[model samples]
Each structure stands twice: as structure tokens, then as C-alpha cells.
Target chain A: MNAEAAQPYRLVVVSGGTSDPSSTRMLADRIADRVASLAEARDEKVAVSVIDLRELANEIATALVSQLMGPKMTRAIELLGAADAIVASAPVYKAAPSGLFSSFFHVLDNDLLIAKPVVLAATAGTARHALVVDEQMRSLFAYLRTMTVPTSVFAATEDWNSRELGERIDRAAVELLLLVESGFAEKVRTESWKSYQHEYGSAGGTELDIDLSTDLMRLATGGSAAPRRKP
Target chain B: MQFGVFSVSDITRDPVSGTTPSEAERIDAIVKIAVKAEEVGLDVFAIGEHHNPPFFSSSPTTLLAHIAALTERLIVTTATTLITTNDPVRLAEEYAMLQHLSKGRMDLMLGRGNTAPVYPWFGQDIRQGLPLALENYNLLHRLWREDVVDWEGEFRTPLQGFTSTPRPLDDTPPFVWHGSIRTPEIAEQAAFYGNGFFANHIFWPSSHSKRLIDFYRRRFEHYGHGTQAQAVVGLGGQAYIAKRSQDAVKEFRPYFDEAPVYGNGPSMEEFTKGTPLTVGSPQEVIDKTLTFQETFGDYQRQLFLLDHAGMPLGMVLDQLELLGGEVVPVLRKELAARRDPGAAEAPTHASLVAAKYGDAPARQPRPNANRGDNVTGGSPYQDGDAQAEYPSLG
Candidate 1:
């Protein structure tokens, strides 16, 4: 039996780098592994898929723009959409993410990221461009309406000294796992709210503990925990 | 078996007497060269997209769409599709439409691009290039995979309940090859998605190209796409071929001296020795290219740069015929026979799209329900308040 049966979460790591023993990939793997462990602690089986964008770099543009979606791209996009929470890492290039990473994103439509929670990470040669996750990545995700985890991790060349990289990876893993745990916990509460919606109309009084329609309506709008007063 | 041609679309002076081809003539030459490439039975034909001067293919999709209509089996690709400058939303919809029109003979090479001036020409800042490529591609990937999308990102306006259409024929998207001569990030991006890596191995040595592709292949398997051998690989080359080795060298030397990219660079022999550029007979070019396989490993496609330096149309046509008829067949068989069973074949538009799904139309099943854009005429949603909510942006 899988752990966290009461509430399940899917963890996806999207890594963009072209080295076998890559720091960014190690970061992505650690993030995924940590999230899965947290989910397991709660009796939930965390499903994970790591997508390496380099392997599909060639057809990205045509596949995205073409009227006929290719099979490989379709499968990749499906995996992206099914994730409950995501940890995305890319090596910095020309002061931001690589063209290939962005090309993969450019090929996808906007609807795939609605209300998704993402933890962003970046690897760069120097600390001068470490803020790319915030300056560039934040701006991009903001447009997609994805709820980015407030904390972003940026690692420069100096951050990794063999031993330090392992520790940093561990730290990032913990951070990502915490984010996933919180995200899934929120999902469970929402599910419960949906179940309770049917019970709302039965109450003759307006003193119900939960107004399900209002909660759902709030979620559909900005997906914030706060209730929205309809105009 | 690795033979491909790239069109730079430059109107250069004919070095001997100092006369240049008109832009129109250069563009016309592009078409003729592609036709010749097909006739020569090359593996692929790639046309670059450039908005600035000295280059004519601004709209690659438009040109490729035309190329698809003209040719039967040539694997048409973009030498460089600016991943940083273009919007992913429109990029997705437009390509989907093109896929239907082309019947699967389309793929693209993504690059951040070289001309920094072109960035502002398209209302983008070159400073934000890396971020733009990252965010925009994330959204584009989703558009292709998901039936409907609601996204918001930094680079473009938010998409609310959006679905890019027409859908890819058979719900399969084209294969992607990340073309890069320098950046390791591009290679990483290709690996991240299990896509192909094309080290435009034109100017560089086999050693440099090897490192970049090897980097990509390693990450590809590390991310669990497949083994390193299954990673799709392509490369670009430049060559001048003739019947005899000395004759080829003597003829191409003048053109090489006058070449814009290499004009001030090393001598012809020195340059060709280090790079993939070969000035030799058909057999010599074959020998040089075949040796690349041992260095780069089994690659899928090998595209060559043939039509440059104002080489006469008649002479260029002759080179293609010699390359296609005399050399390609032998190399193709040799490469195929040597490839391991564990290796994955090159993924072209027709083959990959067909293998994944099928040859089909590039239209969505229900175009009306979520006709987000390009739904102005004959849309059922045109009735009443629905139109107000989703105005016909067309």
C-alpha cells in the first residue's frame, strides 16, 4: 500500500542541462526524492517524472506551432499537466535560462500552468546572475498564474565543492518536500469542501460552517485561500 | 548518409568580376538549391529564418509551408527558429496549422539567435533573452500537450481558458532539435526534454562538437529518456565537392577567400583541416564525412552548407548531383549497416509524427467549443453573449 492514501500528490522535476553528472539534474533529483519521501510519510505514493528538455529540443518549435501535435510532445505535455507540484531547474545562459528550456516552454500553450505551484531553481557560472529565478523566472511564471513557492534556490559555481553540492541538494530537497506536503494538504481540504457542498443546501439556516459554492468560486478565480465577495 | 543543405539567403558579389545576385535572385536560388537537394537525394534541407538584411527567410514557417507544398519527401527544417523572440501562444497555434498543411514534413531548430539588433526589431529586449526562452517555452510545451490551457507567465499576457488550434494532426507534435554551436544550456534543454541536439558543426572541430553532443546524450539518459545511443543527434557541415580533389581545391579557393564569414580568417587548408569544411573531390569529401561518425558516434542527420560565396547556380546544381547520386547512396548504406540495433533512428517530421500517431489533418475535433483564437467566421459561439465574453480576435 502506498503512503499518504488520505491525500496524494504528484511531484515532477523539469531539468534542463546537457551534462551527465550535472549539478542541476542532481538538484532536480533531490527535489523529487524529497517530495516523494514526505508524501510517503503521510501514507501517500508520490508519482514523479523528470523531463530532460534537451532530448526533445529539435521538434519543439514545429510541434508546438503545428496543427498536428507529435506523439512524443503530447506525452511530455501530459506528464507536465498531471503534476500536482513541480520543481523546475535550468542552467543559466546569457544571464537567464537557456534558449532550449524556453523553446520547450514556448511550444506549450498557457493553459497548462493554471494555479500550479512551482519551486524554481537555477544554476549559473557566477553569483552575478543568480537572481534569474526571481527576475526572469518569476515574471514568466507570474504570467502563467502559477503559485510559485516564495523561496527560490540559486547555486553558483562556487556553491558546489563536491561535498557542498551534496549538502545543498539535501537542503533543496527538504524545501521542495515541504512545499509539496503543504500543497497536497491544501488539496485534501479542498476535496473535503467539495464533499461538504452537497450538505449545504440541506441546512435551513444560513449559519452553515462552509459555503461550498463560494469556496469553489474563490478557487476558480485566483485560487486563494481567502473568500471572494462577489460583486 | 549525413547530407543536408542550409540556405543563408545572402546576396553576395560574384568574386571574380565583382557582381552580386539580387535579393530576389538569392531567394530564388534558395528554392532551386532545395529542389536540387531533393534531386541529389540528400537526407534533409534546412532554410534559416532571418529578419535582418543579408538574409531573406524572415518567415520560416511561411517558406517551409511553401517548400512542403513543392517537395514530396525532403525533411524541411529551420536552421534557426528564434526561441527567445517569438511568443509561445501564437507559435503553438501557427505550427499546428502548418503541420496539417504539410502532412508531417516539418521540424524546427531552436536557437536564441545571434543578431542582438533583431531582438528589439521584434519588440523584445536582448537583455531578457534567456528568461524569455525559458518562460515562453514552458507555456508552449503545455499548449501542445494539453487540450486546453489557462496560463500566465512573465513574457506574454495571461491566457484564460485558452486552447491553441488547429490541433496537431493525430495529436502528435513535431520532433525538436536544439541547434547550438556554443551554449551548454541549449544542450541541457534538449536533454531535459529528450529532444535532439544539433551541434551546427560547421565552424568548429570534431572535438568541440563531440563534447556538446556527448554532454546532451549523457543528460538525456540521466533524465531517463533512453540510453545515450537512442538520443537523436544531427550536425551541420560546409563543403565544396568536385570530380577531382585538386580541381575541387583550386576552384573553391577563390570562393573561400571571398566568403564573408571566413574572409579574414585562416587559409582554406588550415580552416578545413580543423573544421567540417572540406574542399575536395567527391570521394575525399565522403572519406572526411565518414570519419566524423567515428568521432561523433552514430548521428541521425548530417546537413551540409553548399550554396554560399555566390557559387554559380549551374555549378551548385552540379555539386548536388554528384553528392546525391555518387556519394550519398554509399554512405547511407554504410552508416545504416553499422548502426547498432539499440540505437534510435533519426526522427523527421514524417517518420516521427507517423510513428507516434499517424498521417492526419491538423484540426481539432471540436473546433467550436474552445475556438480560442482564429474563430471569427462561422463560429457557433458567435451567438449571443458568448461572443461578448470571447470576442472574435480574428
Candidate 2:
């Protein structure tokens, strides 16, 4: 079933961090809940799937590089690929983002994110590393050609206790909802230097769109999705 | 050159005055510190993976995928992705998807985790942990490079025929840096594959890390990756910098004394004297870190455990500023001066993957060979002729 069957807007929550009842995961939940609530308020049907990467870490990792997808991860990957918008949250590790989270992204294809919209948020102590959302996370979004909502919410530990957090999260969620309703707020058009066709008359460009749905069938039969890149 | 910050995921009491931040507060604090690392300009950001209590992240990949949608230029990597317990097949696919999501800004370091009990919980025996890592990684390597594989291995069931999904963006697998502290076996594994070797050299002095890295470099050459100098190496370190050395030590002492990992052993002076830990001025850190090369020879990546020791997020950010503004430029210059003209510069995600499994450069595959049977006689089975059934072993 597609999102249209379940709901028009789906919120996919990515909770990244170790399993110590992290505030980062809480932050992810808060944003997700807020988004769900907002969707309900607007009388819009929305589906929410919380993928605690910790639970599926083993299978997901094994499935990714080897192209072995368990039923659960396959469902999760499909949701992630088809989601209209996403709210991603992680606790900062070191001065950047968590390595576990990076590992998860490493297995994804750049084409999966083309023209998708995303909302980025992070949790940290004090106000020291708040800018990581823009400096680090947003940069990755830009590279993947995803449309990131402008207003990101970065909450410090102190901000959590403050009443302002709910309002802030709600505001970010509302902004994302607005974008989801409106479609791409900013149109990003990459400057293509050249375009051509292969000897077999296959149209190719710096970025080309092929029917992966058919490729998926071939992969199912061959039991492999490995690219034909020579080592 | 490498720059990164790692988190300990702890909320500790201020040793001077018992003030323990709630777990919630500690987690939020870590998030901010990571964002700040990027703002100040750092190359890579890595987070540790732990399954037990006190360590918040059991799912580093999910977190990383989220972070991938967040960052731009910074290369995201794991300080340690547990290779012992985690299934290599999943590791392969998840990271490939991440590479796609991040637009090629992803890579990781493989390590056998510190904890022991984590093994059995995952239905694995800690006794066979090293074997699992070795065998699993070998499979993972093949999964990334090969399009279709008929693989059978000890740990996982046989794959009559298999291909991972969500093909890699650049058709390149993420670069891997095998991280180890004292294990020469891990070094050998890394060297055998021509992968980078990282010494999370926090506990030991440069001399100790040097022995392991040298072993890896030598073995790497033996395996035909390149010369010893051409082998990629990364080091892990710890530091707390203040303008004044006295103040730096004074402020960090309590946390050091109470840290779950470091609090138990040697006296502060003794620990500082022998280990890579440095609690002093920015200049002192630079001086000590630069000496790493003298001891270990030319290295590639350098990451520090700054967010650990239960230090507050505010103080950690201050350290990052100094690191970005004061430390990085000087270290870059000094390392550049000392670089071996013959040795390749440190490999970034782009460089490493290209060197390993990049798109076919000269020997390109013929375009429509698989489409028609005219050339090599296509498989007897057409696209949908049958399910391509494999007989049951039982």
C-alpha cells in the first residue's frame, strides 16, 4: 500500500543514538508527535512510522551492503524512499553527528533523495553546537538534492525544560507541514554541463531518470541488485 | 589531515560540586556540541556505538542516515561500527543506502566493541567474535564490488544468488578505516584488505600505537596496497585545552577522576604522562599531537575524545573553537611540511572509494551485451521464464 492509501502525509522519524533513553530520541519523538498532531488539527490524514535504528541495526547493516533485506528493513526502506517529508533527529557525537547515523546514510543511494523535502533537528547541551543542524546536516541534504525546510529547531538541554520547546517544535513541524502541502518551496535546478546518449541509444545525463521499478524486478529474479561497476 | 569529535554520551556530576545533569540534559548537550563542531569547521564527525545502558545509541546507522540529511561538506563516519556482532550483510546494504542518501559523504571505522555481554544478546559467542568480524567483512567486501553473487559462508546462510538493493550512488562503497586499540589481529585484517588502519590511541602512548600501525603498514605493503608510507593511518586522542595549562587541568580534573572509563586507573599526572590524554593549553595539545607523527610516522586521520569525561557542553564548544581556529591551521601547516613527498596525502571518502571500487576507468563493459544473446549466449532463462528456483539443501 502507498501513502495515498494510508494518509496523504507520512512522518518518518529517525531516532539515532545509543539506547540510554536519550534526550535526542525524545527530541525526535516530540517533533514526530507534534507533526502528527498538526496534521490531525489540519484535518489531514497522516501516518507515522518510528524507526528506532537501534532495534534493527544488525539486520539493516547486514542487509544494506549485501542487498539482503529482511521484511522489516525492506518496509522501512520503502517508507523512507517514498515519504513526502522527513524529520530527522540525532544527538551530536564528538563535534559533528553520530557515527551510527552516518553509517545508516552511507548505505542509501543519492537518487533516493532527489527533490525530497526534509526537516532537520538536533539536541545538545548548552548552546555550543546548535549550528550543526545547518552546517552539517543541511549540507548533506543539499548534496542529495533534497529540499530542506528553512526553520530548523535546535534545543539545548536547558531549552527542554523551558515551555518554549513545545512551541518551537510545533512551529518547526508547522513549517514543514506547510512545505509538504505546498510542495518544493525553493526550486533547485542544477546546471547541467552536458547530456548524451549511449551506443545503445540510452539517454544519459549528469543526472538521469531510469525506471528502477523494472530494475527491482530483475533484481528479484537474479537475487542481486549489485551495480555492474568493475573493481 | 583529519579532524573530528567523538561523544561519550554521559551526563556526569561536576566532580568539584556534585551536580549531575539528567540523562535528557546530557543527550541534548551532545547534539549541540556536534552541530558546533561543524560550524567551527571540521572534516569528519564520528559517534561511538554501544548497546548497554548509559550509552544512548544502539542504532548508529539510523542516526547517521538522519544526520546525512543534515550535513553538507563534513564526511560522516563511525568512531567505531561494531564488526564483531553486527551482521556484515546488513552493514553492507545500510551503509550503501547511506552513501546514496548522503551523496557520497559517508564512510565508517570497524571495531570490536569494548563490552563483552553484547555478544550473546545478539546470539553470538564472544569467543568467536574475531572470527565473525573477519569472515563477515570478507563477505561485505564482495557484496559491494560484485553485481550478482552466489555466496555461502559460515555465519549466515548461503546466498544461492544475491544482490543488495538501493544501488550505491557513485557505484562505490563507502571507505572503511579499521579502528583498533591494541589488537594486532585487527591490524592484520585491515592490512590484508588494503583498508586504512586507525589507532584509537587514547589509552596508550604513541609508542604503543606506533607498533600496531607499523605492523599494519608493513603488512599492507606485503599485500601490495603500496609501500609502508603509502598505507593510510588514523589516530584517536583525548584533550582539554584552555589558554592557561593550569586552568585547563584544574577544570578537567574532576571529570577525569569520575569518568566511567578513565577514572579508575593511574593518577592524573601519571595518566597524562604516559597516555595520549592531554589537558593543557591549545599549544600544548598541538605540541603533543604533532609528536604523534614522530612516533607513528606520517598518519592520515586524527580524531579526539573531547566530549567525553563528563565535561559540560559549553566547555566542549570552547575547546572546538580553539581546535578549529587555533589548532587545525597550525597542525595542517606542520603536517604539510613534514609530509613524505612520495607518500599519498590522507585519503578522503572520495579518494579512498575511487582508489578501491570506482567506476570502470578504461576497461568499460560493453553497452548492450546482456540485452541480446547474440554475443555470449544469454542465460537460457529469459526475464520471467521461471522463478529461477534453487534446490533445497535439506
Best by TM-score: 1
Candidate 1 C-alpha lDDT tens digits along A107-138: 66554655567878888989898789889988
DockQ, all candidates in order:
0.01, 0.01
Whole-model lDDT per candidate = 0.71, 0.71
iRMSD value for model 2: 20.4
Q: Is the docking of candidate 1 incorrect, acceptable, medium or high quality?
A: incorrect
Model 1 accuracy (lDDT, Cα): 0.71
- What digit string (tens of lDDT, one per residue) describes model 2 on residues B330-393? 8989988998886767676567556756665422222222545332222222221212235567
Off by over 4 Å in 1: A1-231, B353-364, B369-394
Off by over 4 Å in 2: A1-231, B11-24, B353-394
Query: TM-scores of all models?
Result: 0.59, 0.58
How far residue B302's Cα lies from its native spot in candidate 2, in Å, is 0.3
True contacts kept of 2: 0.00
